[model samples]
Every structure is written in C-alpha cells, then in structure tokens.
Target: MTCIADANVLFSLLVEGHVAHEVARGWWDEQPDGAVGTCLLTRLAVLRLLTNRVAMNGTPVTPTEALGAWGRLGNDPRSVHVEAEPAIHESRFISLVSGRESTPNLWTDAWLAALAMSLDYEITTFDRGFKSFRGLRLRLLSMADK
Candidate 1:
C-alpha cells in the first residue's frame, strides 16, 4: 500500500527520543520499498518542528541535523515524493474549511489531507483531526506515549 507519512509520524521516526519513536519507526521500517511516500508540505512541517526550539520543548535540533534527517528520507529509494499541487490542494482545502471557523492550524491539517487525497495516498499519523476530513484515507497509528 502507498502510505503518506504525516509530519507527526515522520518527526517521530526521525527524532530518536520522540514519544512515538519506536512505534513510528517500526511501522515505517515495515513498509516495502516505495510504499512510503510524502509531499513537500509534510517535509517542511517536519523540518519546522525539528528546528523550532519552543515547539520542540526548547530542545530543537540544529539546522544541519534537520536537513540531514530530511535528506535521509528523501534519499530513500523506497519512498515517493509527491508534487506540491496547489490547485487541487486549494480546492479540497476550501471545501474542507467552508462554513466552518478554522484556525491556521486547521488549515494546515486541511492542506495535508488535501495533498494525500489528491495523490490517492493513505495518510499515516496519530492525529485525530484527520478524522474530520471525510476525503482522507488514514492509517491511524496509536502513539507510543498514549
């Protein structure tokens, strides 16, 4: 199955001490080559989280480390990188947030779901927010810490 790793899953897989590290890594490793995929937005989200000191509880990784980790994921031959197609994403985003008061955080979630749906990929993550996106196919992972 082609699965898109969400920022949360990718972050846990890359950051050793993350609460979901083992669970994410185990699932990630079990995917066959080319079965795991992601889009640019997800990549950037992971990078931002990794380098944001305040967001990461004041223990941010260095820029070099962030880039290195991102590169590793990109370099995986088994991984597929989906294009950042804005039109499709925007259409889905608009449909998703319409008639609802949404914060920027929710917009981000919509963007991720849009990307996955556009590419016909199932999203892998622990975020329950994706449940609101009826168009999204989610492989909901149970967080290790939970």
Candidate 2:
C-alpha cells in the first residue's frame, strides 16, 4: 500500500528529539521503495514548522537546515513526491470541508485529506484531527498525547 507522510509524522522524522521520533524513524526506514511519500503541502508545512521561531518552541532551525532536510527526504529512492492535480484537489478539498461542520483551522487538514484521497494513498499521522474527514485511509501512528 502507498503511504503518505503527514506533517506531524514528517516533523517527527526530522526532529530527533520529538516524542514520536523513534517510531516515525522506524516506520520511515521500513517502507519499501516507492511505497512511501509526502505531498508538497506536507513538505511546506514541515519546512514552515521547523523554521518557525514561535511554532518550534523558540528553537527555530535555519532555513538552510530545513532545506537540507527536505533535500534529504526528496533524495530518498523509496520516497515519492506527490503533486496535487488542481482540479481534483480543489473539488475534493471543498467537498471535505463543506460536508462537515468544521472550524477554519481544518482547511489545511482538509486539503491533506483530499490530496491523499485523490491519490489513493493512506495517510500516516499522529494527529487525530484527520479523523473528522470521511473516506480517508489513515495509518494512525501510536503515540502518547503530549
């Protein structure tokens, strides 16, 4: 099965000190060639969060460092970078958002869900928020609430 790495899992994989680091790392390492990946949205989110001063608990990473991490991830032979088909992506995103009662914060989450749905990739995430969107195939990572 194809797997899509969500921002949470991507972030955990990048930051060795993260609570989910080991599990994320292990899962990442075990994926067969071409079986795991992440979309541009997830990549952007990882870069933004990793380099943000406030979001990263004041320990902001340098842009260069974040880019290097992204490069390394992309260079992995087993990884695929999924791009969104704009028409399908937008339509699915809107359907997911409008079909449910959701706060404005869920817009990106909806996009992620839509992207995965369109590509038929099962999402890997630690966030339970993804559960709100229907018809998503999720490989929810086992992690303690932090």
**Candidate 1 C-alpha lDDT tens digits along 82-130:** 7666567778878887887766578878877887787788989888888
What C-alpha lDDT values do all the predictions have?
A: 0.84, 0.84
Q: In angstroms, what RMSD does candidate 2 have relative to the true structure?
A: 2.2
**Top TM-score model:** 2
RMSD of each predicted structure: 2.1, 2.2
Ten-residue stretch with the least lDDT total in model 1: 82-91
Candidate 2 local lDDT, 30-133, one digit each (tens): 89989877778888999998998876777989999999998998888878888645568788988988857767658888888888888888888987888877
In angstroms, the error of model 2 at 40 is: 1.7
Number of clashes recorded per candidate: 1, 0
For residue 18, give model 2's deviation from the true position in Å: 0.9
Error of 1 at 28 (Å): 0.3
Candidate 1 local accuracy as lDDT?
Answer: 0.84
